[model samples]
Target: MILSLLGRLGRLWIVPVALAVWELAAREARAVYFPPPSGIALHVYELWFSGPPARLFLTDDAVAHILPSLGRLLLGWSAACLLGVVAGVALGRSARLSQYLSPLIHFARSLPPPVLLPVFLVLVGVGTPLQLAGIVFGVVWPVLINSIDGARYIDRQYLDTAQVFGLSRRERLTRVILPAAAPKIFAGLRLSVALALIMMIISELLGSTEGVGYRLLIAQSQLDILTMWAATLLLGVLGILFNAAFLAVERRVLGWHRAAL
Candidate 1:
């Protein structure tokens, strides 16, 4: 077990080596904007991870910034997933509805999410609502497109079999269609996770009293070089953690699909 674990970790050898090189380069250059990784790590520890043990080493700043970002990210992403799946599946199942809405859907999808920020703000004002609106609008497209394609392109054999079995429309969608489309849906979901993270940050940067993005923006404006770097490093770590966790879930959920294939 130890050897296997070591081998798996060994595959990440480049990460530490790269950080080491960055540390040495930053130290040699002594640039104000570019601090060493060591300094950034220390600053991050002090800024957010220096609380008591009971609090899981999370300081006030950490609770204030990290929690809001996490809450918004989760809420927004969940809504987007629900909306995308329902809309996509419905559209895919109905040729007439898709024909009527295709142009509008494509037009909306082509516009950047940030461009709609003003509209979101006008509707929901600032704070959590705006952030969620931005995130959902930005991240829903991938899932929407993939789910539509997946549902639309299902093997005719499966549909015919479901019909022959006297399955209801709801049953066909829930059992046959969804199961067969799992792979493509998962692919879109994984992409949306990253996009949700990004949109969360962007929304918070533009508006919000506290969040991970707020910390980064403040640090940048204040010219607190180490804190800025630390915030950026934190974001990178969060991305990796989110992706890894999602991948694990995906693997488990899709294991049956893989076996069948």
Candidate 2:
């Protein structure tokens, strides 16, 4: 246990060390675009803990910025997960439906979410709705595709047994199909979480008045390198936290799958 703890601690140091080296190199090279780690850390600390001279959001604090972004991410991701799983299950279970929708799904998936930002902006007028829409659009495909594949691959023997027992359609689906497809669905959801974060940032960068991305843009415009770096660091932290939480949930929910693995 001690060795495992030490190994984890050592692994954590790797990124900080690599970052330190990068900062030193950038400083030695005297690149205006590249700031050192210490400078970035200072900026992050101030932005998160202190307020700027002018207060835009309530409390003029870091939590203000982070909460909005997190809220959007949650709302959008939840919508995508619910809709994607339903649609994927439908398509996966029905060959005729899958064939009918194949071209449409493929076409939509081919287009990048950024390409639709202008349309969303025009229709939704650059508020929470637009942000949510963009995130949902961006993340739904991976989840939908994965769910379809997972559901389609359900064991024929299981289905045969369920049918022989004269199970109701809903019972068979809830007890058998969904459980079998859950791991794949969860995998897709995990991937979607990352994508959702990226989409949220991108949308905020484009025209959002608030969020970590928006604050980063403001810092850049004001030439506040430290604050920019701080925002970047916060984003990294958020991603790591989100992934860890997701993995915990997956492990608890899918404990039965451990033996299979």
Candidate 3:
């Protein structure tokens, strides 16, 4: 147990070491734009965690900036996953439909998402709707393409066995096809989550009034380097927490697959 704990701490040693180095360097340099890590940490706490413990320990600033971004992230990711998986499965199952849509899908995926931001702004206006559009557009392709590939390439024997067992279409899909495709689906989900977070921040950076990205932009505009770093640190922490939670869910859902492997 002690060795396991030490191993974990050893693995994470770089983080603290890097922070300590930065702190020392910044103190020695005394540059106005490059505040020490301690300053950044203090600012982050004051800006986000100064509230009472009962309210999730979130300050008003945290509520305003963090909550909205998180909400948008969830909404966009859920929508993208639902639409992507459904469309991907349909396309994969229908060769004719896949062939028909191939050109359009390739074309759409080729375009970078930032290019669509202006179009979204014009069509959806500047706010949550626009942000959701950007996030969905940017992140959907990975899940859709991964799901398509997974479903299309299933073992022929599985289908033969399902047919021999007289399984209905729904039963075959739920039990055989989806189960086989679970690993690929989880891979796409992980990629989509990261992309969703990135797109959410990008969407907030432009034509938005409230969000973590917006606050970071404000700090930059006001030349508050310490606050900017604090906001950035907060973003990094949020990403880490999100990924950890996502991994936990993935482990639970894919436990059978892991055991099989």
Per-residue CA lDDT of model 1 for 1-261, tens digit only, reads 999999999999999999999999999999888888888889999999999899999999999999989998999999999999889888887788888988888888888888888888888888999999999999999889888878888999999999999999889988999988889889989999999988888888888788999999998899887888898999999999999999999999999988887
Off by over 4 Å in 3: none
Per-model CA lDDT versus the true structure: 0.90, 0.88, 0.90
Per-residue C-alpha lDDT of model 3 across residues 1-261, encoded as one tens digit per residue:
999999999999899999999999999999998899999999998889989899989999999988999999999999999889989888888889999998898888788878898899999888999899999999888888888888899999999999999999999999999988888888989988888888988899986889999999999999989889998888888889889999999999999989988
Could you report the Cα RMSD, in angstroms, for every candidate shown? Answer: 1.6, 3.5, 1.3
Looking at model 3, residue 206 earns an lDDT score of 85
* Winner on TM-score (2 vs 3): 3
Residue 89 deviation, candidate 2, in Å?
1.1
Show the lowest summed lDDT stretch of 10 residues, model 2.
51-60
Off by over 4 Å in 1: none
**lDDT by residue for model 2 (25-137), tens:** 98898877787877777766665655544653334566668889999999999999999999999889998899899889889888887898888989998778889999999
Say which prediction, candidate 1 or candidate 2, comes out ahead on lDDT. Answer: 1
